[model samples]
Target: MPAAKSDSPGRVRRIARLIFRVCLFGGLAAIATLVVAVLVTMASLPSFADMMQKPNGQTVRVHASDGSLLLSLGPSYGDWLPYDRIPAEMRNAIVAVEDRRFYSHPGVDPIGVARMFYVAKRLHDEGRRLQGGSTITQQIARNIFLSSKYSYGRKIREAILALAMERKFSKAQILELYLNRVYFGGGAYGIDAASRKFFGHPGDKLNLAEAAIIAGLVKAPSHYSPSADAQAARDRASVVLDVMVDAGTLTPAQAKGVNLDSVTFAPEPKQNSVRYFTDWALSQLDTIVDEQAAPLDVWTTLDKRMQDAADASIRQNTPKDLQGALVSMENDGAVRAMVGGTDYVTSIYNRATQAQRQPGSAFKLFVYLSALEAGVKPGDPVVDEPITIDNWSPRNSSRRFLGPIDVRTAFAFSINTVAAKIGQQVGFDSVADMAHRFGITTQINTHPSMVLGTSDVRLIELTRAFAAISANGNAVTPYGILKVSTTDGTVIYQREAVQPRVLVAPFVAAEMTDLLQTAVNVGTARAAQIGRPVAGKTGTTSSNKDGWFLGFSSGLTTGVWMGRDDAKPIPGLQGGRNPAQAFSAFMRVALQTRPAEKFATDPTLPEWQLEPDDEAYFGNPDQGFGGDGAPAPEAQDEVTGEVPDVQPAPGDVPPPADTPAAPPRAETPAEPQLDQRWLDNVLRDQKRPPQSPPRGN
Candidate 1:
């Protein structure tokens, strides 16, 4: 009976052993099937993220304010330094923090996994979650192939894939890939941009302190951001410096030399002072560079010196509460400087290239150019007397007839009546065509009012038109960029705005320039006259709001505009006052360094004999004045010989015309009325009274 019982026990033990064996085999089979299923799923899935294309090792363009290039973009591993160019210290920092036993273990670290599991279990008991042990290869796999879903199943797959990746790549290869893929924030995807952002220097040029700060950012970019948290970032950098020292990546003294405080994590990016030019240049990026490589380098014809001068002049000379713009371009249409507005930070309305305002008397240049083409000579007389055409009787600024003035004098003084008559005789279409040929891209209406510069034209187009005069009638459109290169210095595109010549004749342009110079010398634009010879026109719209000064020298052409953005009239401010002042200030500095040169003249342009008859253009007015009765002569005090209020001349009544009436006759206001209501409103809103009236009263 004892033998049988013992046999039964043995049988029972054998059965239990068999059951255990079957269960273990089934578990193995299930695990193999699951592994195959995960592999199939991963294989079938699309890429986790689009791979960033690296042209010449990746890049982003950095352009100067005037569209000139400061430099090109390169990789974090020492720009163009290749994977092998990585410093041993950086390599060590990455390896030590990411994977201490990277060389000794396969892609999946079993010891690390065991330790992580113990930690995770402890944390779970405390109702917390912790990171799983992810090896460098595991992270690479996840970055390249898997979604960052942070799931248990994903973790398992990551471990398996990591092991698989280890079989395919060497430790060094994996390390390099990991270093390049890490995000360091502030638009810096890799160490290169980070190095630049933090140290104002390149990654390869980084000292031990800068390197430590950058290395520390990988742990928690925001937490160690130098700009946002300088102290924390410095502390973190100190820890990195100590680690690097212990790793012998840096000497003790070298680490000590690295002042963590000296490492600025967020260095101020170089600002583009020439905001208008930079904005215009960026607008041309699509045409200048390949759409696929727009983030590359762009080289332009922008002259920094000229840009600085233009900007300073615009800001310093523009009146308070007024918008201003200045643009400077080379004779060939390469924009050297541009001031879009007084302050680009406060407002980005690029008045130089975008804002379109009436050209005012500046438009008379086109009218005069047309009349010249129509056989009218510069010295030909044009009557500045009252003239009417279809009920539009334009008057001069002085509102008094200037009989038999020469065309040169008429244009220089911006005589409205003479310019209108010339427009009538030459035909508005002819003048419009001349403007078009001069690179006026904006539409121009063919109306008599167009003669007085009624068309809306941006400063960019105006400057380009003036460029024709500087180029001896050869028109060249202004552009921002000259060449674009890939991140690795591969020239992708080049631009030079030298198109086929579009002008009547170089000599015609030279002659026109000669007449314009007279305007600056002793005419309406006298304020713009520099010691050096300059040519330009002053313009004031009928509303006295928009004022303009378009001028140029042999090497450059510039346009200045002053006006309120709201188009509100500015009393006492005229083109010659503010616009010309700003233009003169800018040109003085801009042309200081430019060689004193002169535009070439061609004496063979369509020759026409000078006609000195002013009556031909002015003719006669059909009717007499239609306003209040003529005033009497000035009254004199017999006792003290004091002059009394003067009266208008007999039959000198104001004429009815489409042109805005001459501003109200100057008068001394009463003390109570002397305070401007508009100014009072401004001061009242600020809880301040208007400053005491100036002593001028």
Candidate 2:
């Protein structure tokens, strides 16, 4: 049968050649299409040729008013480092883990592309995230221009731009750009910032392990940042070390010998050390300086020494659960120091400037001042006996009430009954008006209890009021950021202190100062004495929910408040306790460097005398309750359950400070029947001395 005649060798060769030609043609067509696509993508990409020669972007460096670094805001980049300054270890570690064939590849590694697809398929089947397969150049392209969203178009553009980059710059130049631009966690935009943020050092100082850790972060900055999670960073570094060894950039023995245990992380980023002040200043920045107007120098009015002292005092003295706030102002209303809370990091709530807590008895200043405005003298008789106004009854901090006390003694001891009676006599509207005139901006409810300090006020407003009192009734508007200028020395904003306005007669404030001095000298705020003459009042809510001390020397006014954010009572807390102590502690340090000063006093006034009846107000300090006074009322407010310990709640009174037996309910003094002529003068901001030679005496 011709032995199944096999085809001739020539015929077989011809058929094999035809089949090979067809396959080759198909491959050539595919290559040509890809090249054309690459060209089109390259046409749209920007020039990377001279990018390294030009500045990337500028950062907004923030400085304290004193010219010290505070924190930096953004242009989304950090200091650019030359390639040589960046440690070799840092660059090598990056190359090892990110792209081993980086130097040899024209731009993109086809081998890497294959492995990426293999891993992607496996991960997709397992329902895991598809990992990035970008080479270093491709990553640079994406970071510089293209979007990160996964799509064929992005990948194509990224690859074409990477090829373009390869042609435009050397390997070192590309790596330099990469290190200077890639984000490395924190608010860091590049290696320099990342290094400083995590290690508290610069890029040139990075050790092998540090470099490896940084290299590891290229994959996921936030998740593996040493600042956020040291363990995660360390583990990732180990992986990077292994990759380095496999890439021949590091030896296995060397990698094994590296210790990650000694690595220390920087404190949490933006852990806002001075958040309250920073926030306030930053807000002002918007109005005064254009955020985009280059860098600026903001000179704040803050005294660093005072701020530190206040922060420490609040932290060390207040109970952990109990929050505290403080604001210290110069007599001219300059905020020298402020502490918004125990921790600004855990919470950014600025209690000193933002919180509107009841001033407690601290608020009695307005009531007493109002009475003074109505022609009531500091020595005028003020009955502290049991008094009921409508449905409200007020008592002293100590439950026992002294029968009849002078207005000065009543204010010094923060007698709630006397203050409430005074508020009633002068009219609640008048008292509220006085507070508004002094600096309070929060709404004031004109209920009878208002005199007991049930009205809400910000710590800053109340502190400024004390400043006004110290300045002899001249109202001061508190201010920070004294001046702001451009980095190049162009003054953009300058704060000019306005001449203080007269809120009350200078002599009236002076007399009030003499009366309040008694508080720190022998009454409730005794804890606040700074060994210098201080005029201030103590305030505690009936529920012990808020405690406060507002005081001032002739030069500085300081106020402190301690309470729970939720307004819950802190058992045993009082105005004379932590709040007063903190104020004193802060003042002791704040005033240590300054000349000791005292509040101006009007000695010719009867304010210095203590009546025997008022002496019974606080029974002998040794023996608790002494006088036969009304029993202390309940700590809870009858009008509202929100009893701030600022003043004695209706039922809450001073314990047996010596007092006479419950005196008959005194008739509310008819608005002092002042001589119409004298009254008209007082209402006109008269500064007459409190001890004037008699109108009728």
Candidate 3:
């Protein structure tokens, strides 16, 4: 008792004063720290009042040429909404579940703050994570202005910013900001977008049931959203309705009537085929107008029916590993259909628009066209006879020559020897020039092998060349966009129809068609017959790596290419098999309803006489043309391949796998001179072509 007694009243008083001074100092330091923190948070914020007038996310839509929607690209982050535009049900449901005393609070709810402190203490004691109890104002402050980090400092900043934002904006504006800027679910930011995305209707159209469902999503959009889980979303919606009924926003009877099971859900998006075409057309947009100037309304030239046909044909005809491409354009060069690949999901590489592959024997068309231009008649006698040009000795694909076959016959058979000779006789310059004038922008190889289609080229250019022939020599550059307008219907860019430049004379094209029709009727491309006269060529590259069937009908021209992406050889796939069959199938489907029109050409051959097996390839080209049946220039004597010695039946016709491949060049002291000398002598011998071995020998 004596030890517990106070030493003195004066000493106790001194101790009390010391303690008071220390407490006062500590309080002052804490106040100063809080003041500094408030200042720093104010410094970090932007002018919130001015930010209201600026735009939020903007969406860009792409449409097919037919005005059907393809896809939307953009700032799909969220769509903006005004306070008045929000439905009462949606707004009340949110307030009831998220913050009941939102209107009465200054910037933060003191009751919520105390509850969070209790939660923080209990969670810390349990070694678990703390949970948020933020008011709507504080949430808006954090999402719109402050970083989402949760720390003592960040919490302090959030409170300061919330108070500041509340003072600057009205309660209604703050609520509008919260509802529009808050993350709802499924990449949606705001009740407006969430409502539209999940219900397929606007936010203002939301009913009590929909509003409760959307409000429930605010807590965990991905977990509770109907798009992800139906049962979870319904459970959450029920909880939200209970909260609403407790808050007096909904009566018990109303809550009972609001069932999530009866609400309609949005349907899944339909698949789009025009995505690739629109992508390309948009790129071309940069050249003419800035699509950024306004929301664009692009109209393309894609024919939905033909596009589907092309896609279906590629899938059914080509192997899974071997990719294929098809591009079809009208004679005037308007791209009507394009199938970029079998499946755009696995690959976005537009083979029709972007891939460049060797056209193989397809290039021979250009070579023969040059020969035709140089006054070589379609019936002109050309030797399939094997002859050595220095080290480059060319042989026919049959490995056995048909002796002196006419140009029309050689072309129908895709004979390599005669093609190489034709390219040699005309000089490679004329062939290259013809290609350039016809819209082949890619560089052409000047070698003699160019005639055999050894060089790489895009399918578009090759298709364009064939289009020119179909148009009777009118040059065409493939174009897709027909018109581009703004959302207000003001035309930003309009493509006017203009007559194209002519590349070949009308008669030359007709003569070329006359020969090509024979190819489809009785030659290597017999598989491509569509019950009409189709003019085209079949091209198989060396090693069977690339096969092509580039052909045209009366008004439509189509090109198809098939090959491995790695350029490896395909087994037993020649131009006559897969490519030809695909081309025919695609054409049949594409023009199934359109009336069949014969090709517009003079001097056409009769279909019944020249059956696929008809040995009467003996009917002269000049005779069928109803022309001054000019005597074909004689072909000079040369060792073509070994003559088969006897006529083989039509079924025994060997595929001209390689128009004669260039045998290795012979080594000679005067190799270049010999090359020049052979070229010079080819045309001279054209008038005296070696006579064919007697038919049926």
Query: How well does each candidate superpose onto the true structure, as a TM-score?
Result: 0.61, 0.73, 0.63
> How many clashes show up per model?
1, 32, 22
Better of 1 and 3 by lDDT: 3
- Per-residue CA lDDT of model 1 for 1-697, tens digit only, reads 9899879988999999999999999999987986676566556543322323332234556575465555444433334333576666677776666677788897778799889989999999999887747877887778666777888988878877776656655676667666666666555656666776766666566665666677787778877877668788789878887777776566888877766665445555544456567667877676655556245777777787777677777766677788888888877777888888877767878888888898887887788888866767665545557888887777655544545546766666567788888999999999999998887889999978788888999888888887777777787778767777765777878764455675866556766776677566445565564445578887777657787889986577899998889998765456766677667666666666555554353111101211234222111111111112222111110111112122332222132222223232222111111125633542343343212111100
lDDT of 3 by residue, 442-526 (tens): 8888887777777788888899999998888888888888887876888888898887687877767877887777676556665
What is the overall TM-score of model 2 with all chains considered together?
A: 0.73
lDDT of 3: 0.70
What local distance difference test score does each model get?
0.65, 0.73, 0.70
Show the colliding residue pairs in model 1: 76-192
**lDDT (Cα, tens digit) per residue for candidate 2, span 248-306:** 98998999999998888777654543668767766777776665636666777777777
When 2 and 3 are scored with TM-score, the better candidate is 2
Give candidate 2 regions above 4 Å deviation. Answer: 1-66, 70-81, 99-101, 104-135, 138-163, 200-202, 245-254, 262-273, 319-321, 345-348, 499-502, 596-697
Scanning candidate 2 in windows of ten residues, the lowest lDDT window is: 665-674
Over 4 Å off, model 1 = 1-180, 199-267, 288-297, 485-499, 593-595, 598-697
Total clashes in model 1, counting residue pairs 3 or more apart in sequence or in different chains: 1
Q: lDDT for model 2, please.
A: 0.73
